[model samples]
Target: MGAPGGYGTGFALIVVLFILLVIVGAGILRF
Candidate 1:
């Protein structure tokens, strides 16, 4: 998926945000 340019940057950002949301949701449930 290394086509270079803006595509990879956007994809990575989306993946990071998704992971962060999952972690926050799990923490809230535990509390």
Candidate 2:
């Protein structure tokens, strides 16, 4: 149970980071 929770948290963090990167890249390209 603990392992699954940790894995899910890590996956969420990675997804958030990926989204931020994509938004930043889009903003830079627009400007």
Model 1: what TM-score?
0.81
After superposition, which runs of candidate 1 have C-alpha atoms over 4 Å from their true positions? 1-4
Tens-place lDDT per residue, model 1, 1-31, is 5597788889899999999999999999999
Instruction: Give the Å error, residue 20, model 2.
Output: 0.2
Judged by lDDT against the true structure, how good is candidate 2? 0.95
Q: Number of the top candidate by TM-score? A: 2
Residues 1-31, candidate 2, lDDT per residue (tens digit)? 5578889999999999999999999999999
How well does each candidate superpose onto the true structure, as a TM-score? 0.81, 0.87
RMSD of 2: 2.5
Q: Model 2 clash pairs?
A: none
